[model samples]
Target: MLKPQMSPTRELISLDGLWAFDIERDSRPQAWTGTLDSGLEAAVPASYNDLFVDSAIRDHVGWAWYQRKVCVPRRWTSDRIFLRVDAATHEGRVYVNDSFVGQHIGGYTPFEMDITDLVAPGEEFRLTIGVNNELTNITIPPGSITVAQDGRRQQKYLHDFYNYAGLSRSVWLYSAPQQRVEDITVVTDIEGTTGVVTYDVQASAPSTVRVRALDASGTQVAEAEGAAGTLRIEAANLWKPGAAYLYNLVAEIVDNGEVIDSYTQTFGVRTVEVRGAEFLINGEPFYFTGFGKHEDSPVRGKGHDDAYLVHDFQLLEWVGANSFRTSHYPYAEEVMDFADRHGIVVIDETAAVGLNLAVQGGLAGGATTPTFSPETFNDDTQAAHAQAIRELIARDKNHPSVVMWCIANEPSSNEEGAREYFAPLVELTRTLDPTRPVTYAVVMFATFKNDRIADLFDVMCLNRYYGWYVATGDLATAETYLKGELQGWVDKFGKPIMMAEYGADTLPGLHSVWDMPWTEEYQADYLDMNHRVFDSIPSFVGEQVWNFADFQTSNGIHRVDGNRKGVFTRDRKPKSAAHALRTRWRGLENQKPGTSN
Candidate 1:
């Protein structure tokens, strides 16, 4: 929660490079099997499913073991050390030298375990991590590990992305002071030309905390005292959409005139508000025009790749966009940091996707995407869902890039007792940080009349698919129908709304005579229609395409090679729709007062 930076008193070591990995159907013991190199070798912070040539390993729905050897440095004897696993697929179990350390359930967030006594200075230890990518009904992204009559195991999920499982993020060892900073929460606002930053610092022990705000040149602009306080910056260089200027802040914990722990965090001076169906950033409505993207690529799967992160933003910038939603799951911390420095609005969503059981269970009667539902919102599932929300907010609350917190994406909101399920979740998010707005991405099947959870949101985010899913190949009828749906949302609530997901499945080089579906021509025309309808609606505040690019997903009959709804291809090549987006967004980018109230 400390925004993941180098600790002044902490010694950091990268446990990346190569790791011993093996795939197994059953749980393996902690004992070392002879030569780990002779077995299948894979890189750390990557997906094993895409590493091998055999389809069996790619589709294996059971446990995979990752082992490594680590020795603590003797120079840091008095510091408290911990093993930090950034992510471990769906479920993870950690062990240090045949002794069980701890376990974490969710896969997308960072989890750390204290191994101070278990590991000694200059002593080597076997660090075994058992990761299971098996998805059950209770998992946040619901899917099943089903075996056929021939004993062939397969991974089945409702989401439209491949189940790439492994250590998708970095793993490292870090040392901290005996008493150090545990977490920091920051909330900022601007009054006229002055910037106000209010923060709360939590430490392991009681100590005097000193806070300093520095400009881009690293010169101190303001200072404050105490564990919780505010710091003001005069004539603050405001963080805007295109030109994002950031200021650095350092929080130090001192004990008896000794600096025990220090942390440096960066933030932007900005404000977000919703006033009478207008989404305002920095006291005015900021038009959002971007896409809902996934952490996906060619060979790396969902693994965090620096090259893909940099290229994807370039595509977004080329399209003249300003915002995006971490649709279906929370992205890595590095993505948030990039958005902070580059000035992009983010709707940080939780991994509570695939909760709509009706669509997957044939109860919805339409061919909709699958939802992650445990069927009923009972104790264990609810607690896991709630904990994900808490950790997401805790880790991302200090980021100036995050404008809103999307609690879920396409959950079973219209089901019975759905209000009881999400009300507490919304209230919990508000309790954690009351500064940002809270909302979720509603699926296309959700209706305004029977919508059980839309009232709990500050902004109405609807994933409408009028031209593609409902009307199919007809853009004429889809245009009229789409306008009706947009008007229905505004008439029902009159709240600020965003078109979270919209686009058609388009295949590159697939030509059509008259703009048929699946052709690149149809994609551009489909988005053109949606844009035409959105520009006429006054209450519509934003339009986020369904996907920035095509990505991998489970093999199915309907999916040709995965969902082809991207403006760009899987390799980041632009389809025809990419030009349509650029042509429209470029004009909007130069306009002031994004939304006319």
Candidate 2:
């Protein structure tokens, strides 16, 4: 039996109480400074739509103010107090005790502000946060239309998910010692049959670095030394997925022979690369058989506990999946850590969604027409996009399970100057970390046309929703159409391709062909068709279904409750299609070349 995984330490500060809120109209700088009595109770981290049923939080475009009071602990004062916001929609300005702290301009990336200077030990301080998501603001992306305050028209992107805007992830206050480990990077290099592991360490201060490699028995197999930088160790004990061999890397930041901070990261020494459309891991050909996953749970939204994440991982492992894609956005850091321990390959993505296609019009006096044309290509918009990418990479670059850095997921193919927008971002990722591959999910024909930036990526991924999105008649017809679309890119780009996302949405627990395409039966049949296509196509690398679990969607169209394309329900119950995929991927593990299991 495998040892139970240890959970990371966490403390959540409740923001779900009474808060003073005020909506601002058209202001030059969009500032909120006045203090007001708390009138209504709004849950922290919950969307404004969930609390105020009548408030036009979703379609309305302007500034919203949220104010609350928080008490700091006396012990926490000795260490540095950091206020972390996991996610805030659009743009935000944070203030502690009327003192400006910092500002962040992205909806999906995490940001932190040092509030130690602004707070008094064991004293209560008023916290104020102002958010502006106005559509007409040239700094922010424009919607399909611009509506008036009384609800007219505005510009917005046209999309298929709901826009539940607020602090969607979490807010927390944590204390770290002055000289703590800031970040870590683990890299595995394999030459012939020998494996070499190197660790790039970062610290808050100058400290001695002690590195140790341990085996399953807790015996030290290798040891090396360096100070506050890169440390290397060579060993023959490499790890493979099924073989389950793993090594523990312990790094100690020492100050005058006293340990100031220490961090232990578990990593397996293995190398992975794509060769002629086949993924070779540890010098052996491997295929990525998995699903795309969202962080949201049914009633919990994005507030699900660690048990939920672990339960989903257990289900994925049970179904014989070896890979997963963080569809649309980046997942929490702990989720990637779990993947590393379980030996699952992860494609870490930045938090960029349907910005190019969200409805442009507002509810009041904004524009009327929905614009699918890209508006995320502007200089300011591009800077905001790049910031999100950089934050994601900074937070997750250390995880060993992550094999690919995904820039975007199915951005608008018809957007103006898309190549100009994405080419530089791809280059930026390569500059940051050249060890891992960079990829973006593309639509069939629309994205492949631009070969100028196509050569920038190591692997090309296509988000093909053929049997579901288009009326391809049947699975065979869908397969034929998809192959024809991908063939051009494979020939022209000379890179391995992955069917990044492909799945059909269906109502859970509902069965029958009468419900045809929208029923569970249809979903299973769709997976069967996808498996056949993946198994037969030699030019394609592998496939990841549209989702691993049902998640919240804000699009006014298609996904009302959530995107119902998951192979598992939001609560982590398996759907029929999940088992069908297991049969195919597991069977592949036993089959030899030219032989079917």
Candidate 3:
């Protein structure tokens, strides 16, 4: 799952631009026919939903085709070419010049096809990619589709976010040598003044491996000669919050002292752990101050935009924040890379949202059903969930910014069969990567008293809306209830607690003198109340607000345009709550553990 990069022994090309787009209305199987017949064109590397004015296009449920004719470089004749799709929403199928090459399930993670035998260099071929936006009971983020009398398939799910689907990430055409480095796994550690990097390289053939660690200035600090060995640096510069320092690890496969393959991996030397009532980074307690963010913006929907990404990180830094959670799904790799370079801590999560049937029923006033019933999220769902965990760990295991792995968000931890469902997943995460802690965000219904899976996690990540959802604008009672609930958590389990989500939906410029929900003043006041309770609890280690910005959601009466819980608007304009957070977080920017600003 190594990201495609340009190196001395590798060639890269971006297959990003306008592509022939058309909808597949019938459920019948369709094969690639070299070119799409439809006249509609859509941009690659973006969600096709918001780019069109047609509602049918925006709400497309089944398969869609994106075809682009590309030319392979003649110089890549001796190399094995690859077609790497950074991401395909839910499912994707690849075709080379008219024949199917490969397919992959799971939306957020990357998948590639080695198409060396399918196409020839110095020639043009029609590259077609079919993307499906369907989700069923067995999918990671489970959903259902029901056909109406008019034969229209409507999608229903437990999550509140919109199903903006397409190839929202980059597509790459890269070349690698026949005997190239296949994969590399790196684990970092710090010992007093020395930085330790232990690496394992997987190559295609038996070759001499040489590893070099270079500082930010491109000077070699350490070198080792092995496929698996450690590079120790004296007086190492540690990667800290707000002060990121990266050391590039260059791994090479040498044949008779001549390099045959080379790849560079940028990594930060850091360590994460959970000890009693504290979440420590680099052997020191680190407090988190940020928000639960989404890959959302105006027009782009869930598309990955470089401008939006840079601006969002700037805003996070401007607000004096150091961390954020990839709320419900794994975001684009570019987002993760930015976080790594900028020293932003991340709670990397899977798309295991909407697993709770009760939450969906509550949100829509529907009949509640057992979440883990035979007809619902059962064995097949568990298998899909397990696969999601495997892919997530394989993709993001080496990221220094990812301090924790959030397996699921807002699952029905209080329901029956909850323990059986998540217990093994938690154990699986630890078995895969024993470096960091594992957690799942707790819904408001899954309290400390009734939650069955909280004990399995290392940190208790609670997403509660005390004043908004429970007390309904009653700040005083909200504060009291919040404190009591948090105290119950501390008394029940002496683990460190983090407020993974807490916010009031506030419309921009909507001012009210009194404590009213949806008003700017109320959102600010609600956060203040929650902060007071967090400070009162000894186990509280972090506070990530519900959202970083307003985002699109499915059509519902509860949502106006979309979720307004963001401290900033969808266009990156700050709401009043943003200023309030800035003032508070600025003071707590350097606050030590167990101390108030």
Candidate 4:
């Protein structure tokens, strides 16, 4: 799960431009060996669904093909060559010169295959990657596919976000030595003014290992000569919210005093814990003030773009926020690296967004049924969920910016068998990485009275749409109900509560003096009401609104274009609710410690 980087011993080439693409139809053979027959091209590092104007292509189910030709570098003959796909939607299979190589199931994580023996240096080979967008009951983010009367396959899921699919991230061809650093795990702590970083390295083979801890100025602060050891820094600069400082931990493989491979991992010296009703970072009470975000844009559709990435963080800074959640899925690795450099807190989440049958029924217009039955989200689904947690932690455990792990979002905690389904998963997450808190976004239906798995989590991340979905424009009743429910959680669980998602959908230009729904004025008023309740509860630790910006969703009458609960519009334009948040958060920023909001 180590991110590919270029060093003196390693080289990287980005396969991130136009590639030949086609869709499978009527049991067509895969374009594995020769050039694709469609003669159509699609951009890499982007979803193919939004790139075309054809409705059939936009809504196509099943698999799509992307093929390109790559020349192996001449110098890479002596090194091990790898073909790395950052992500391939739900499932991806790779073929090199018509020979099947490797495949991976997870859509949001990385997968790689060693191709040194398959091709020679200074030679060209056809690289074909097939991505399947279909999700079934066994997938991590479960969905059901049915054949319509017209004989076309249709995909339906419980999640509200659009199921954008394809090669939504970068693909790379890289080289490394036969004996090199495989993985690096760093756990950081602070004892008084000194920062302690304990690291463990996994190598391809047995070799003498050298580790060095260097500061921002490239001065070596500490060094060790083992595969696993600790580095201590005197007067260490701690990485805090809104103030980031990083140390580079370099690992080198030495064979007879000659360096064969080198890799550097950037990490921050920080610690996170949930003690009683307070969420602490670096042993200080910390508040989360941000939004639940998605890797979505106009045409890219979850593609990782540098321009959008920088701009989104800039917007988060402009809004006077300190934290955000990767709402319903694990985002690109580049996003986590940026957060680490910028000192923004993250609640890392898995792609377990659609596990609730009741929520799916309400949104997708289906009959409510037991969600955890054998035919639905059963043992296979739990196995996939366990793998999702494993990959997520393995990829993100070293990040200081990620303080908590959100295992699922708005699952059916009120349904039968909820406890049986979620208990082992929560235990697995804690076993993977014991440093971070564990939580799941609770739907309004899963309340203190009926929620079976609330006690399994360390924090209560409640996603309640009281005014928008329940009360429907009645703020007075919404406020009362919200306060009562929050009080119930505090009384029952005695844990820190966070309003992980709460907002009203509002059109940009819509206006109403009476504060009607879908108006900018009502969105602002709804936020104020939620904040009043948050300030009154000592156990309420944070507030991240429903969304950072409007995003695309499956077509339905409940959505106009997409979900409009974002404080900012789809294009990063701030709505009136954004101004309200700034006014409150900025004041909190200037408020003295121990003072009330």
Candidate 5:
């Protein structure tokens, strides 16, 4: 399947801004008629969860409908028109003018529907979408909805993050040529000073897919014509961390020497491998130094905010970080494209969190049952989990910034059905794209001895809160346990290892002795101890901190206001740990803002 590409010829109409919204506790209509009865309006690219003043409406876990009107351009009559939903959370059922269009079940990826015949050109049409945030065992990021003692419905799940829902992305009407280039798959390799770019483009019809590689100045450097071929770039500048240089690959659909449709995507000439105990980028050992981040904010919740996005990038630059993981889900495509321009390494992840089967173990303010809870062993949950992996790869496969594909974040690898659950998923990810390495973040509770699938990945990704979760404010004990645990992984797997997550919850301005917990000094000491242990291990390749910034989580005693594990506060202000990280990471010249080795 090919991903739709953008072009100068393809026209787009923004269906953003205000939209009529309403919530229903009972079942919503399968097909709505005439004018919608939605009573309230909301900003399209924002979360409805945080939009209302009433907490009942804010936390409602049932069906919510979004209705908006869009006019198809009169000029697009001759073109192939389609509707692109950037994202709709959890499960979504869409309709246009009282007619069912399509339904999509994932929250973090883009899905499109052809509405060429549904709407006449130049006429306005009603667009309605019903979104359900209720997570069952069959959903990827699974959870349950229960009525609380206060007569309010709330979600109970595995992940530590909040369940913010609604039309969390953007909606658009776009026009493309009938025989446009559908998808482009690019694979790059640097040999000596030369670069080899192999690409396969899928088109709508039998047309010559003219592929061109353009330099940074938009000048053509290399080109080829056919469905699949290679173009050699002479004296090619390598794309590296910090020095991320990009070349544009443009595909044009030409018939009888007349240009019909075209699409362009960015690619970096680089390669990554997890070879012999070292993680290599461009064939040199590379160490990842950054944080594992979530797309979260104050009022916006997990909604996309461009201002916050740009600010986060600038902060990463200031603090000397060269990479980050999209922790529990694939973020907006805009964020991935930005990484391409900036040379930041990204470990793109799927929203496969909370698949644990254990019925016990709840943190300070959370309930006990796992995400994809009791029924996690069933076939439906596994299918949904696999589908999420497929969607994530298909959407993000073309990005050069995506050096790896993370199958899941902290799944149950130690439970009774662990192997049967993740084996097929791991196989699916590898079969989809073998160019990138694949791994899942291993939770500490799923120790090396108990994890049946520990050696299944190309690299071992460990998320440990040794001092915070175990030893509790004792750095010496934390250091010893961390070393022993890491050594056990090495002795068993012998693969390149990374600390996918490691942090302590610390409140800003909260000061105490370094031995105390939840204080600035304690967080810094805990991280320092972990770093020391990592340096001593030869197979240790990367250390992406637990979080980039403090973020809001569902309320609990474990958190003060929210999770305080960020190096920077929720407002992007640097904490004591952020400064400490900058000082240590700066000394390693290869890890400077623009390069990694």
Candidate 6:
């Protein structure tokens, strides 16, 4: 008999109406002061490709402007108003009433600006956002590049996915009272069988805060009291995977005799660590049987609704997947929260993908042009990475499901002068949260030296597509070659190994072993051989397929859309390989120790 979880009282203000857009040419400063007359129309949460019928406007890159008017209610004046953007690509400058408010550089993380001081109650205010995605002369990762098409080098970006740039996620206006909860961090020490909850509380005025922890049966287990700063709760009912005993935290901010602000969060107590290559959760060895998922759907690139999120998790659960990786980028916070409630382990990743190919030039065809050149790793890139990392961690740190902090995905270890760049970034992750292990997925290059950065990580993961990408037609030979590589790493580093990524691209409509690269049967066979290889390696800790769904990729070769490496179609239809992998994972989980199935 568990008490029902309290829903967060947050309102989403839809910013999906008509917006005016135009391209900017010169680098010189220009004011958006004149009467709004661009006339170009676009909708929110819709990409530029969705707006224009012309291929030029749909594909061309430059500066664009989005303008709209928003009104605030008179009664909402007593609370703090925040203008939040789910995501904006490249760089953007936000303005209110033609006055510059703030600027953000990242393309994937959420950012907010306090507009309480600038907004007037019950009045329509003009909000203008200037977005610039021009090809920079800098050498940082993810810049436009010229590639050889039909033996002629043509200009293209050195990224792995389609650049469907815009205000991609969501935009909203919300009001919170002046005195409220700023941040909350929950840490579990399951080895010691104890729980520590820390709340970084902020308030506009002085107030006393009382915190209480209640078990699933509504029994008060632990309590604490503090002023307007960090509050900690100790020795509480801990949370585990199968025995997921969660607790509810209720915070009461009282000034006089009245409750000023109240905040409640459901949290679980658990500890996750990497022992060599094996991951231990709550002092018991656990294997990650999971899939790599992108935040995209067939009809909507990233426009998935709440029901879709829940549906995706249900599918994973059905397949006996105990873990998930938010491939290449940070997912919506709600998704992580749901993972916590459902007892699934999560690898919370940053939006720092595609930076690898841009920074290192040799892997994708020995091209010398670097996207994120080491020369241009300046304050702007650093600031953007820092902000993205901070927001991602701060938003999802409290969830018990998140076990590892992935700094970047598939970055090159053979970069020119930045061979040790990943090491420092791994250190940065530890600085932020020393409790969880830090790791990154690296491409399986024979000459690639991971020792430079491998020591910084608690687990070593390899994104190998040996049979599919390297061997192509001979999966049996590819299996042998991949096993050699895995054994070599295990003997050398003695760390736990995870097949971070492995899958074959296949077309949804086709199914045959003869379909070299685009057949569902071929995909299923590739996974079968790889899983068999994994069975022989006892040091191998886990396996997550290359992807969970087919997604948009501007860099694909066979398909103009993207790679079809998913176990499911973009529309969430199950593939034959998905069912096979499900059976394999279930068998492994049910197998007895010391007996090979």
Distance from true position, residue 404, model 1, in Å? 0.8
lDDT for model 3: 0.90
Which candidate leads in lDDT? 4
TM-score of 1: 0.95
Candidate 3, residues 1-597, lDDT tens digits: the string is 899999999989999989999889666495666568789999888899999999889888899999988999999989999999988998999999878998989989999999999888899898999998999999978899988798888888778898888899999999999999988999999888899999999998888999999999999999999899999999998877777789999999999889999999988898898999999988989899999999988777787889989999999988878899998899999998998889889999999998888875663324368888889999899999999999999899888989999999998888889999989899999999999999999988888888888989899999999999888989999998999999999999999998999999999988999999999999999999999888777678999998899999999898999999999998889998899999989887555551122
Query: What pairs collide in candidate 4?
Result: none
Position 18, candidate 2: lDDT? 48
Write candidate 6's Cα lDDT for 1-597 as tens digits. 011122243334667666877655444374454445767876676555545766655565655677888998776767677787766765677888878889776666667788988898788888887765543333223455453554422335545666666665667776766776555555556435456555445445666877777778887877777742332345555555534567877766777756666667678877787776577877667778888888776544554357788889888877778778888777766687678777878888886665545334443435365423545443455455666677677777778888888876765554553444555566677887888988888666522334346656788778888777688868878888888888877887778788889998877778664747667888888888888888788777788898888888765456646768888887788888889878887787765221111
Cα RMSDs, all models: 2.6, 5.6, 1.6, 1.9, 2.5, 4.8
Tens digits of per-residue lDDT for model 5, 1-597: 334444666887778898988887555555555665657887788788888897867878877888988888889878898888888888788889899999999888888988888889989999988787888777878777788798778788768888889888878888998888777888898888999999989887788778889999999999999989999999998888878899988888887888788788788899988788888888977788899998888888888888998999998888878899998899988899889888889999999887764524632313244333344446788888899988898888888889898988877677666777788888999899989999999877788788878878899999998898888877888889999999999998899898999999988999985488888998899899998998888788889998999887888887887888999988889889999998877766543222342
- Candidate 1 C-alpha lDDT tens digits along 168-276: 8888888888888888777888988999999888888888999899999999999998999999999999888777899988889997888999988888888888888
**Stronger candidate by lDDT (4 vs 5):** 4
Question: Model 5, poorest ten-residue lDDT window?
Answer: 363-372
**TM per model?**
0.95, 0.82, 0.98, 0.98, 0.95, 0.86
Candidate 5 Cα lDDT to native: 0.83
Worst 10 residues of 3 by lDDT: 588-597
Candidate ranking (lDDT, best to worst)? 4, 3, 5, 1, 6, 2
Give residue 85's lDDT in candidate 2 (0 to 100): 76
Name model 4 segments beyond 4 Å from true: 29-31, 360-367, 592-597
Expressed as tens digits, the lDDT of each residue in 27-104 for candidate 2 is 536654658454644556655545565455445555677788888876565667778776666677898876789888
Worst 10 residues of 6 by lDDT: 1-10
- lDDT of predicted model 2: 0.67
**Pairs in steric clash, model 1:** 354-371, 354-372, 355-371, 355-372
